[model samples]
Target: MCLNLPQMQSRLLLISPGQSYRLAPYLKAAERLGVSLTIVSDSRYSLTREVADGIQGDFTEPSALLDAIIAQAQTTPFSGVVASDDSTVELAARIATRLGLPTNSIASATLSHRKDLARRQLQAAGLPVPEHWQLDLAREIAPQLQGLPYPVVLKPVSLSASRGVIRANDPDEAAQACRTIARIIAPLSNPIERQTLLIECYLPGQEVALEGLLQQGVFTPLALFDKPDPLTGPYFEETYYITPSRLPDAIQQRIRQTVADACRIYGLHQGPVHAELRIDGNQVWILEIASRTIGGECSRSLDAVLARPLEEYVLAAAMGNPLPVERRSGASGVLMIPIPRAGVLRRINGVQEIRTLPHITDIRISMESGQVVETLPEASSYLGFIYSTADTPQAAEQALRNAHRALDITIDPLLNS
Candidate 1:
């Protein structure tokens, strides 16, 4: 969509966790568009406070946080609220609602983050959803697995980026996966989320992600990403996201329509939406939809398609500016460099060579040499991200793959610690 700059400098409240990679992009976008950005986070040590006015509150205690925000609003009122990560979307919605700003309903925001609730809502709306049921971690799980479908995916109700998401092929595997995921959730601070898991019949098909925006219940398609890697797995660690999808034009249109329908069902009437879906033959199953943009540095790929960083669109929309819908052209992609094992990073090689490869735009290694790294099913962070833009989806996909191949990464085993 084309940008419609706001008439005056609009003050925005951005609710983002301290660890989010999204803060910087939004900050830069706000500066370019002349928006006054205030960062509200749960961390006192947030670096964003150095530049932007920041408010730190205990996100777990929303009532207190809202009170603090309201107090600040009385002096320097905020025109809108935006959530920079999935973990903060519900809180953002609540804040927006309390301030009488445009936002999704609190129930809709909550449903978007909780898989179990979202599945039920979608099914009730007659959307194509997989067979699913919730399991209580506090109860005996073995008997509950009896007569259930084989090859099901067990995932935490609240976690995103595929953390604690595992696929099991049999009862034994399911039981074991349940126990492991339980342990993963145990350390989490949310007690309610720690006690629930969503188990669904695994749908087999190629996966694709749609990045779009919504305004007053109308959806605008921004970009559609093709996940070239086969996500069929015991653990789904996302890799390459290449767009302009190779799929037929008709199928892509259907995918966009399905997502728009989901937004209506979720009552998401404003801001950015990121959705993941699986296509099996003519059937399109909704896997996930978030009331936020695509996570991590993956959103950088959209810059080539949108002709501006996606954060600009997100920020402008939050300020109630109308965005012009632009047709996507050319091809761009990103590879979320995966952590190969659990250990401390020791060394990285071939970075210079990878930078020289054709179509490779940038490579960022987010982890330091002495920092610890982990693999998926337990890990949430990627080693870094590799970006590329090309003439076609095939070329873009190949560039990312080629860049990954050039990397020689080494990690010391965790047992040695």
Candidate 2:
């Protein structure tokens, strides 16, 4: 559905990492909305034809990035600013705030981006969050790990997509996990993120993801996804996400309410919200909340139910003309194809076979053959994404599983390993 915005000539500035998978979809959405879009990233994009107005600025340096955006605004002012991913959301918020555009405050974005800060804010607000501890990486981790709860999950403060997240069963494991996480986050340029790690008591339950939009501090849930695959992990690498969730209606409402409360606590008043939570019996535990649409190609799953691409809503919200949140009947899902091992990909077999399966919509193999792939705690990208749709959530989830089973991924062990 093409959204007929009042500002038909509006230009949206999309801030994202150069390698983000979200850029193409958002660009397509912008075109569908009949709006001009500019690309802003730290690296150059090959889509020079689609993105005529591109700005390359280091995301690590906010002062320089903001200056560049302000300079660009003088010539071609953006009607709205949107962040395509978690890494760029805070900066997007900062840009929006600077330009006096509709956006959540920078503090809200920061709280959402930093796990440690989010936990503190949520706890202070009396929200159900796992007991967590922040460890100063500059000091000895072993001393910090002492007397902490066992079976805790340790992760870097700001890395998303479960990168550098590990579950430790005991003190020894916690110490080793911290060391491993340190190495995983070593390449990050942010001093605070590089120097701090969060260890939180692992909450065991069925996990779910909420995709919603916020307007004037009110959150409207777009989709509630059931993570059929158990996230009880030594490392939390998410796989399956099926929606309209199979959970009871009342429980689902509580999950939504929890997310809304979290948004209120963070003072998030506008744009898309992607929240992850754990349902432990009757208790709803907020795992993490991000001020962005659901990550990766997973957003495509919503098209089956929304009757339009999720990016349309996101773009509409960014442009300060949020379309009504509505869902048509049916269920959909996406499998974030997980990398099985650390190695160079040799070949992926059975794409044809998977496509033949019932309800299988698409199979995207993102990692090219011969490209090196890493598993969780260090892995950043998925092998690819598998999308499906059916009359029921079960059928949708089964379709994803069936598709995954049909494929045989072969990875050649790294020479060093």
Task: Output candidate 1 Cα RMSD.
Answer: 3.5
Worst window of 10 by summed lDDT in candidate 1: 1-10
Summing lDDT over every window of 10 consecutive residues in candidate 2, give the lowest-scoring window: 1-10
Candidate 2 regions exceeding 4 Å error are: 1-9, 45-50
Write model 1 residue lDDT over 96-132, tens digit each, in one string: 8887778888899998898888999899999999999
lDDT, residue 143, model 2:
87
Q: Which residue pairs in model 1 clash with each other?
A: 1-324, 2-324
Q: Model 1: how far is 23 from its true place, Å?
A: 0.6
Local accuracy by lDDT, each model: 0.89, 0.87
TM-score of 2: 0.96
- Candidate 1 displacement at residue 335 in angstroms: 0.5
